[model samples]
Target: MLKVIFLAAFAVGTVLADGELIILNNPGSVHFEGSQATNQSFLKEVFTVVLGYTPKLTQPWDGVEIRDPFLLPEALVSIVIEGVESVKSPRGKHFPLNVDEVEEVTWQAVSRRLEERDTNNTLVRIRVGDGLDALGQSALGELKPNSVDPASLKHLSLNNEEDQKFIEELQLLRAIAQKIPSTVTANSKPDVYWFVVSGLRPVMDLHGKDSEATKEALKLLNDAVNDLSNAFTDIYNGQVVVALFTNDANKLRNTRSVESPRVRREEKAGELETFDAAAQNSSDNLNTIEKSIQKLATDTEGLVEQIVDALETTTQDSEKSTTESDLEERKDDIDSMHSSENDYDPGKPITLRLSKRYSANYPVIFNIFLWFGIVFFFSLLAICIAIAGMDPGRDSIIYRMTSNRMKKDN
Candidate 1:
């Protein structure tokens, strides 16, 4: 009997299990180092365009630090260059090429000249005036002279501090770009690569401020940035990308949606309310069964007492036998009810589980759509109100009174 009760209790107890989905937004870090004024201006403009709000510029790199770090996706833009001075290299003798005379010079021609003039590779250095640092080096190695490529051969300018810094910066950019996968699977999106170069006044000033040379240099720089942007787009299959330059920091704010990418919640919160209701129902059923069992036990005890009294009071043999028989039958029924085989099965364990629920704020897209819908509705309502008030053909009381007054004046 005891074993049967224990088995039933175990069967009634339940365990419930649940699962959750976690979403992580990618992590991004921006490093901006340069003139305080220029840096602050650029930072404000970029964050405003990206985040839709201008971040307070308390620290030099305040806005660069990511706000939420838990399971941060990955850095979208790893490097930012703002008004940093270019590196300086030792000055060697300059080799002049008349731009008007030579239509194009190839890498082979320049390399041959360098080899012949300075066999030791000492005192002869080359800096491609254009922003083709990587391409120039590769061409020098692989291309032969007489290729007649306009971009291949140009007069190497004397390296300045700013020029050297620019070269190193390009090197860093290339290295970082190389690490990005050339291709991504359809199911996955590639990480972002963002590079912003602003306020190149000093570099531009290296040439006369308004000179043709300065214009050419600026054009080359723009072309390089475009080339890099296209290359990354092709490699990443056009996952989010922002590569732009601006002379005016203020103009940077005009670019829209530069803000950080967001993570969308893919799953709804767990069904905890349903689980709680089920657990409560099971508890109530268990309590009811327990009370019934206690009542049955008390009733069985009373029946046994009545049978014993009948046996003691009746001296007749037949009456005593009948009472004893009735008592035995009642006891057997109670025993059958308490038997494990008849009352409870121990093979199945009851399980009831309640899980915690989690929820994320609404997605940005949903919020945008919701607000746009609301605004459109309100604007439509306003338009209808205005038309109703101004419509002269309408038979409203105000319009009718106005018409009568106008007729009277006429």
Candidate 2:
């Protein structure tokens, strides 16, 4: 018996899941005729009676009509208000309040009313219809908070300076809500979630006549409407059942749904690829520089060894006179080279010295042939010294010396 009951419950739940559950917020009567009445009746029956969800109606006798009986798990509901209407609240008389505003404000009045009742469902998504276009236009251009009649302000009970400031903020919010656009493009997930808003109606009621206040109310209302519309539009674009109360429901009969916008995944992929390519190019350049540095270090070591050998050979005294002259001329250069020992690493520093005595002794060129021999020999030594302190390889004087010697022998 338990197994049979479980199976039966599962089947019913599956069937219910296939259709959408709609929650309607109707505070007043909306008259309809002809095809508009038919559509409203159809929608009401399908959403409330067929789907087994109750309509939240402030006035039951003035319930809206529905014409179509479509099963949609997701829906976009539009709230349409036709003309100027006022409702009495705790604060004062509120004018031009639409179904959307009322629903939001009512939900806030009762703590967690929607959430506690529909634990598994979300609040109905709402959109403003074009019927309120004239109101929105008036709010944008002609509304002013200071223009409200001071007589209507008598009902406001202000206890302190803070209360007045709070009232002012409420007036601003109401004006912002009024200036919001009616049509919204949807861009939300298909899942439904409840939204409860309060404190708006009282503010609207208090400052509805002030153009600035109305503009503020319109802006706030439009932001909320657009957010709800975008949330629904992101997921579904099919036909939606709209429930609204107006003197002429015929205006809402022709209301159409908007399609969801397309996302560009390809552009995102291209950007990722470009970033990866740049990273790889940078890595390759760094690797090349590292290898070049290693080669330079090895060549520098070889040049250091060549300089040490040349210094050792030049220091050997063949004659006493020649030794004294060479020592005196090379003293300054040797001292400078030794000072580099403390400044650089032992194996990294390159020191080069040319004998100053050679220049001083060969000041006169009376014996041209002898002078040429001395100049040539010293020039070769100077070249070796300069090359040891500079970059290595083919550009070095060592290479030139070897090549020239080889060519002379050949």
Candidate 3:
């Protein structure tokens, strides 16, 4: 499920964010080499899309060869070493070879940043337990690739150490997820990472990958993913994209042993014939690998389309959710504004009118003015009546004048 989601997102070029890629490449043989269950073609196509180039084949297929996706500047690539010819590059990367201090080296690779390094190169980390190597080829052969409870492990009493190592590796992955990126270069490519948890391939395959041990391992992985997803919930999709897929579904041929040359003539001839037969088998294996690569290249386009569709669907869903959330918020605001206090009715017109509640008691100034006018009117009326009733008094000018006139007439 994660493989589908992650591969889909990875194929989409529009959502490239400045994030880091963590690859866990578990080595496993291809179960149905050309069946629909195989993931190699899809993987190759995904890598080609992300990396901007396909892995170049330096030489023909050797039993033991690895290809770096980014083509790091310094890595051992030889034509032939001890009868082993370089395998045709499957347009893929190789697993780490050095077993000594593998943990330290693996962590170093994981933690190394762009600013810390002088050149701008892609980082690939390989991890195999040092203790796993200490068990040597004999014990390693006895135990499964990543099994902690192999019969031999029980006999050797190494269950605890193996379990501890697996736990530590899980811890390491969690740490890598939690760490802040100290160095990010100015690159246009998206930070599509792969975290290859090697060693489990011995127990896993294309169709037969669901073993109890594998399930346990995957459960732990799921836990780690959930933890990280919760931690960065806000930016899980937009910023820190997380997806998982099986890196490959095909298996390389098992390493072949070349016997020493015989001294007897008949033995030597028999040995030559055996070598020829082995060479033919080797040729057939090479053809299988080459055809697989071609198929991968051809089928990549289909995978890309499917992944793109998936990404589009995811995008549409996210956008739809945001829109719904926005509408919900707006509705809430409107509901609050048209509250019970207003006695609002949805069918009523929104027009408004002035309130009739403006009537109130007169102010002190209005009362004082009215009283003064009434009192002045009454006093004037009384004065007029008093003057008329009284005979013309000498104190008044009009009365004095009228008295003088009357006397003259007498």
Candidate 4:
């Protein structure tokens, strides 16, 4: 995850190169303070004992002798090359590249030189692309360095294959990796670095301690290495990833710490409590709503029954026969009697007439009473509805229990 994060952060300025060299700490000169004579003797003795090959005094670049144990003497060759040295500094005298004692003599310088060479190669690519685009247009003129070019890279030319290759390689490298400064801590102190090699062989220091935060960090690094090794199948490829771990693990481990178990538990409990309370309240509201709906159903049924009873009584009264013929004749003489006697049919269609004329004539008086009645009735209903909605389904108990358990877990 960390690696992913880093890659994203520096995505803009990254490049990929064909052959990559990730140097964690540039191999620097080992300073052995003494006279030149003493130093030379020490180096000779050291190489003889360590390499099991006697080295003789020879000119610079001419490598010393080595006797192969398995190969015959005639077959095993002794190699030599050009060698030169000066007894004085500030003149032409110089130490070997990796053996320079200057603090600034680091792998970063070497890497940067390599990067710039790659960058030069990349510049050529831009020209190539531009040339391709202008194939039908203008001439793809030869490009050369301007007069303002620095001493470190005055010789590089766009036309030169070596220079072009260098730049191209650098551009490719930028695609693959970025020179990011990673912070690693040791004894609470930190060292900021630009190169974080993914793989290099893990070797113990003088104290035999792995470059890691602690014991746990070491174990994690080892485990990661093993996993990567198994997955890659290519040991060399696997080492690249391991290199990244080996260099940063110790510093990364020291700077980082894990959360305590108790704190995490408490946090979970609080969350559970909050959720439980909310669920319980919602359940109570649901139950209350259900009860109000039931009451409304009952009231509506009662009103229907009263209406049916009133209609039935009127019907019976209308059917009663009168004893006096004069009264019967008078009732028969009423013009609306026939219409009033019309049967209330349950199956047949019925028409109900509603008029706004009566309401319009007494608007002010009716509106006041009508609105007041509606508001008062509904207000009371709303209160009952609110209660029924609260615990209508009786689910609050279950919700509360579940909530409580969640709170504890949290």
Best by TM-score: 3
Give the whole-model CA lDDT for all candidates, comma-separated. 0.39, 0.39, 0.38, 0.31
Error of 2 at 222 (Å): 2.7
Measured over all alpha carbons after superposition, the RMSD of each candidate to the real structure, in angstroms, is: 25.3, 34.6, 38.7, 36.5
Candidate 1, residue 310: lDDT: 71
For 1-410, candidate 2 gives per-residue lDDT tens digits of 99798557544543432111122321112212211111222333323332224444333322234433344234324443332222111121111211222333332322243344555433433222212233234423332333233444443434433324434444433443343233222332222322223333445456554546545444544444444444343434433333322222222222211111112455677888999998888789767766665666566556556655666676674542235455545655554554543344323447679655554235345577687989999999999888667765586766766776668988
Residue 171 shift from truth in candidate 4, angstroms:
30
**Each prediction's TM-score against the native?**
0.26, 0.23, 0.27, 0.20
Residue 40 of model 1 has an lDDT of 24
- Which candidate would rank higher by TM-score, 1 or 4? 1
Q: Estimate the lDDT of model 3.
A: 0.38
Please, what are the lDDT tens digits per residue for candidate 1 over residues 1-410? Answer: 99798445433321110110011111232222221122323332333323223233444432234443232321122122233222111111111111111111222332343344335431112232333454344312321112123343142132565544444444433433443344222123223333434324555657555656445444545444444444555553443223231222222333222421211121212356667888889889877776776777677668767856776676466544455666678667756765533354333588779686544434556789999999999999999898777756657656776786778988
Q: Runs in model 4 with CA error above 4 Å?
A: 1-257, 317-410
> Tens-digit lDDT track for model 4 on 222-331?
34323322332232221111111112233323333343466678899999999999899878876776676566656655655664556556556857534456444644
Error of 4 at 225 (Å): 12
Better of 2 and 3 by lDDT: 2
